[model samples]
Target: MASLETRVTEFQENLARNSVNEIKEQIKEMQKMEESQNFVLKDCHEKTQNMLKRIVELEKTDFDDKFNHITRRMIGEVVREHLTPIQMNFNLENKSIKKLVEEHAYTIEQ
Candidate 1:
């Protein structure tokens, strides 16, 4: 009876040791998984930051292009508005000068 009790006690000790080892191994595996997840999270964060920066650059370029186009169009409109009448007046003056020159030439010929 004593030998049988000793054997049972030994068996229980071995089972407890195995359970402790298994728990330790499971903790190690969880730590490794946590490390892997952290790495992926860091990579995703970097990619997101890069994408946001690229978006900002693209938006700035687009805004600048639009602003330049609008400025040029406005300048063209202003130039046309201010210069058209001046050009027309210069043309009329040139015609009047040519007519006076022709009249003077005719009188000289006579």
Candidate 2:
């Protein structure tokens, strides 16, 4: 029952509708891809954050270990320096006591 002009108009409207539907589908597909990209970026960001934290921890531990080693070495050197004279005095006193005891024993025997 439609004339040529009406049918032509209907054909144009259907073509426009189909084009709009294709555009909507393409937009949905693009949104899905963008969401997937966002998830990947978020995952990578978390991994990078964890790696930075681990690096900081490793640096701190290494620094603390080196500091402790240097401290212990310095303390050992100071202790050795302070104790050397005391050790020598103790050895001299021990020898003097032994000599005095030997002379006393000889006198007592005589």
Candidate 3:
């Protein structure tokens, strides 16, 4: 009877080990799920940023087309508000409102 009791105790210990292994596996699965979700969120953020960049470029082109009608002050305000996020590099080659108007007037004459 004592031997039978000892065998039962050993059996319970083995069952406990299996249960612990299952718990560990579950924990690992949860970790993987969290990692996958993080990757998805990162991808979504990248896509959103790309889309916004393209939209800004399109808006800038449209604004450029109508730049002659907008006053210099209004143009400056628009540029400051819209392009402040990514910023821009300005140099002599980058034309201002007055320069662009002069160039357009020259084109019309020629």
The candidate scoring highest on lDDT is: 2
Which candidate number would show the highest TM-score if scored against the true structure?
2
Task: Estimate every model's Cα lDDT from 0 to 1.
Answer: 0.97, 0.98, 0.86
- Number of the candidate with higher TM-score, 1 or 3: 1
TM-score of 2: 0.55
Expressed as tens digits, the lDDT of each residue in 39-97 for candidate 1 is: 99999999999999999998778777798999999999999999999999999999999
Give the Å shift of residue 75 in candidate 2: 19
| Span of ten consecutive residues with least summed lDDT in model 2 | 56-65
Candidate RMSDs in Å, in order, are 7.7, 7.6, 18.6
Off by over 4 Å in 1: 63-110
lDDT comparison, 1 vs 2, better candidate: 2
Write candidate 2's Cα lDDT for 1-110 as tens digits. 99999999999999999999999999999999999999999999999999999999987787777989999999999999999999999999999999999999999999
Better model by TM-score: candidate 1 vs candidate 2: 2
